[model samples]
Target: MNIIALKSVDLAIIALYFVAVLAIGFYLKRFATSGQDFFLAGREMTAWVAGLSFLSANLGSLELLGWAGSAYQYGILAAHWYWIGAIPAMVFLGIVMMPFYYISKTHSVPGYLQLRFGNGASGLSAITFAVMTILMSGVNMYAMAVVMKVMLGWNIHFSIWVSSLTVGIYVAAGGLYSAIFNEVLQFFLIWFGALLIPVFGLIETGGWSGMVARIQSNFPGQDFTHLWSTLGNAQDNPMGMHWTGIVFGLGAVLSMGYWTTDFLVVQRVLSAKDIRSAKMAPIIGSFFKMAVPLIVILPGVLGLAVLPEKLVPESALQAGQHSYNEVLPLMLARYMGPGLLGLGVTALVAGFMAGMAGNVSAFATVWTYDIYRPYIRRQAADAHYVSMGRWCTVIGLFISIATAYVAMGFASIMDYVQALFSFFIAPLFGTVLLGMLWKRATGPGGFWGLLAGVGSSVAMFFWVKLNPGALAIIALSDHAKPLAEDMYRALWSCLINVIVTVVVSLATQPKPLSELKGLVMGVTDIPKEQNVPLLHKPAFWAAVSIAILAILQWIFW
Candidate 1:
């Protein structure tokens, strides 16, 4: 079952995929000569290219293997991460946020913060985000290594280094251009590799209704199919998460924070050809995001139907020591024969590489623009910064390699990542929300509020760690897990940020409206098309995306 034992055709397919990816990196290397070229692809990407990369950057191991495993462990409730968690926020970014992002001409999210708030907030964000991005990259690397060890029987350390080295070389060579191109390529490969699992799984399970009936029959009185049905209260759900936490914590805070402010995805949209393309990118991505649960989540549910005993042992139905993260690999091993199996493994590898590349690319951009250029070298040439970006990529990948070793101590890759996001992103979003919408938010207010929020999250995290019984705010029932704790922590941290920011802003002097032009909502007007058809408008497409999401919730409800 290991990759070493794969048939020649499958191994060939995997080899060819690596070659093609490397070829793309080398091919795009020439275009990455200047800072703008290296960081933003010279602002030349089409909507579809940016959109696919935007979606595919996130489609890495976390979205693929993590969510699939989540489906197995958490049931249909996992879809919330994709649907309510991603789609609306992506649409929000396209319709409401992209104009400011594009018009500001900022190379990174921290750069935007510098313009909207000041250097204090921007520098803190840049450093914090740079660290968080590398850590997340390590999460993907470790997760992929775990999958490889389980499926291919490769040495985990060997797998980690090989993947890390390959990603670092190419990303350093061609910068964000190579990352975006490969991300689009990985998007196709992921779909091709994963779509078959659910297709064959459905056929094996006797279709949608048949799978539901089989799961019920195999595990009597167990409810694993409905999305909202299991979420009435803390005790009602398998995840021990209440609707309030899920809707507000995940959907409102974490999702918005990640989608709107996290530079990893925003960098993709910022690379688009124009403002329209920037706005359209996430909207196009949202369409695909809405359907991703079918690819990632359904496999876990399918595992429940096909391999329930394996996924959840008799000793644990809701909680288990069994490795549920193997749901995607298990399903692939179950259905895919030689040639197809290689492609499947390649897809997984591609996802891992893409995730790592995306993080490192964002890290390089933020480091070069927000930190190195502004703080270290005040007037470096564009070519000099581009070289610095390349060097930063190398350094960032090394840091991620170190962080991957750190992640070895964690139990669930997804939970570890979520905890990190709660600590950094959730509070960052609180500051971003105010900076963008509330013109009165002062630079001092933004900086201190973000610091307070992150400190609060860290304090809460350690407090709960020292005293498990102290998680009353997060736990709906005694059965609540770390995942629930993360959601509640995000909720509290975000509230603290808002409260501190508003109080500080009220006490401090606000920047004049003239100084806030184009950055603040009331001070600036996003371009409006007077005569374009509704279908062509970004707002119209956002509405369509939300409507589709509503239908999905109802169907899954």
Candidate 2:
């Protein structure tokens, strides 16, 4: 409440950011004249550029604040999202899955589905992806406005309009080219702006040890500092989750679903210059992902140890009460002074805009290529589609702005939108995983299995919503929390998808082996990477990344 509005200097710094990103968009518009250029960044991005953009695409203000809030609520258990929920799947994407995606030469994930299954599966996947992107962009749009209202006391409507319009202008002008470059720039801004919180919070708390002692003293009988120590029993941890939920549900299903199959992040890898670059992009991203908990989760953990006033839940926030999600802004107001505060605000603003840009860019691609190309206007010229893609970006932003306003009325906006996204991801991953690895996975099998998988998830969601008592039955334990419920839901949906696909495939006529060329794994002639130098190879770096993950888990345990 005591935080001041942006000073003249801060306003100047933020203004420069808008000018810079707009400049990048306008400058690249000339280069992104073709469909390939606008949609895929001309497939010219080297590993490092693609890698940073891949990581930054998901580093939006909402992700940072929400996860930081998670740390405050659940403690070090939040790191599992960064580690178990991300690392292994990302490495698997780079090492195993990237080959199938890259070699098939599919424009989008749904495009890959179309080649492997048919129009039925592709249409289903594309439409769902388009809807998911719009909702997610709206979430990012709402997050930007929330940050502005919280820190500078700006009007929410003004914040939302300005952000959506700016993001729209750039992404519409240059498509993925604009989005990727801006995402890379935003990555640097985020680290510079947000890294200060953990640094100053540590100084106040003495260090990690002091913060641990303070949290332990504040919440007696709660296991808040250890990552895996109390995970054996659902009742032993603050998260109220067992290790099976962490390992099988989250680490296997949700992790693979989001990291490997979610098109938003995977689109960045699709822009890499070559196979090796595609393979290496996610590998590079894995290393930086390991460090994100330091900035995101640590700040919330620090807040639990040091904040003078307790924060409320999102629905409980009203009048003068601060929510857990407000911890970042509250900490900025507390420790940061003058110019640094401006940088922090700019970082959040950048994050929000870039998040919207990433979603809109991916939406434009899927809507134009996956949806419009095959269904609406099958005979359109490449230039016409490029024009349509540009138009789709602007249309998507308008929809996102509307969704942001709609989000204002909901108490559980995040949960509802996130559940919509989760409904498709785990099941879609199951379908794609089977289509790639199994020779017997027929077209009808993929379609019906995917629909049934998504249908079951939807059924389960409403069943729990209508009767809260059903959560204990579904999650397998009364001690399971809302987060744990999601993990179990994904695992169940994925399992159902795999089972249905197998059952249906056994009964249907199969596609001949001659027709399955680059699409299926066993039949595809994948080029070997053993000849590449060890330092340059993706497998070597992936191994090193796994080694680092193990060491961190052991230390945190």
Candidate 3:
């Protein structure tokens, strides 16, 4: 059956959503004339605005479709990405890193690297990030098109082009403000659309216990409800990842790399109106982020309980049939009727646009501020930079349209994203972490260490492709999927970055402490959440958040 079960009311709701998005774009255009306004929303966003945008930008079609599909394929182990892989890192950003980021007044993450390391380090990061951002945008575009093609029977090319054009027009006109507002709007719509699935699903399956019972009956001997139980070994788990890989690779390296350094989300928090607001943004986002698994992951678990045939490993190879990626859309089609169905489809579409917009906007900022201004045109006017940002948006979307085809080659959107992160973000995070905390890290050390890490990561990636069984340290099982390869690859890359940075820094001259002030952890004065009660303090809240996560993990285990 076609996923488009929309009626007149449903079509109206979807139409109104598009009109509302365009209206927001037009409304915010005037405010985005200046460079800061265009790139950072004039640094005037409140905590709620920035926080919601922070969470919502990440709650894209990638998260909705990709992770839901991951859940269907890998069971509760997929929840690790949301919980252990995210919450702590987000809290760490709010409490530990935001002070340096805000105080330095860097326009982007690569801009921060320029201050802490040097332009060489920053330039490498900027170009790499700009490429990754557009590729990620492509992933969102491709994933959305695939969903629409499967569910609505729309032409995949038509879907991609329409979404690209719509996102490009609005984002070009209004800049970051348009992206954030639309992201917040998309957030609510997705929740309203997706919440019904779990609510109705739980009831249909007779609640949590009953759902578990049904999943077990459908796939006996396979535990789909426990998060950590399957992590005893690579082959024991549904993800084919051992606890070391999950904890160290994904939980520590990739999670922190993404939450702490990825400019696509960090740019949202950096736009906060005040230091307090900036600090509060990620903390607030972590709260909402914690609840997102229910809306996304539950649908997959429910699919396991009721739609097991669609998730069978060989089912996709049978041709002209649904696969794991279709699980969310399939669930929506099964549960939602006309008007609600339209709303649900709109929610998914909104998510795709939000992801694409996040990447493109981040790319524009990095291109204009980090690359174009410094390397290309050193003395351009603010208006010129703003214009450049607008142009980059258009070009970036076109590049994204091209990259979307690359994403089509992957087994799944989630795998492709993880691969990209391993290639860039893991090593990038190590460089950033050393630069931020270790005052001894010289510019040369930072630059060369990053290069070595990236080079070695690429080499190892090919080595694995040639012989997956060779990496016993990574616990690469013969039956393991690409996701496991990504995890271990990230772990090795991070280790290489850290070791090289440390060794090279020791052999070189350290910058003066004066130069390192407010940049390195030792010399930097951490900001306090002043005048707030104990419960309101960031440290206290971080502790509370960690406790909650631990309890949840234990329960799920």
- CA deviation > 4 Å runs, candidate 1: 1-4, 312-322
Q: Please provide, for model 1 over 414-464, each residue's C-alpha lDDT reduced to its tens digit, 9 standing for 90 to 100.
A: 788889999999999999889989999999999999999999998999988
Candidate lDDT (C-alpha), each: 0.88, 0.87, 0.88
* lDDT of candidate model 3 versus the reference: 0.88
| C-alpha lDDT of residue 52 in model 1 | 97
Cα-based TM-score, every candidate: 0.97, 0.98, 0.97
User: 169 in model 1: Cα distance from truth in Å?
Assistant: 1.6
How far in Å is the alpha carbon of 141 misplaced in model 2?
1.2
Q: Which residue pairs clash in candidate 1?
A: 3-152
- Could you tell me which residue pairs clash in candidate 3? 3-151
Looking at candidate 1, what is the lDDT of residue 125? 91
Q: What are the RMSDs of all candidates, in order?
A: 2.3, 1.4, 1.5
Model 2 global lDDT (CA atoms, 0 to 1): 0.87
Sliding window of 10 residues with minimal summed lDDT for model 2: 409-418
User: How many residue pairs clash in each candidate at the backbone level?
Assistant: 1, 0, 1
Q: Which regions in candidate 2 have their CA more than 4 angstroms from the true location?
A: 405-417
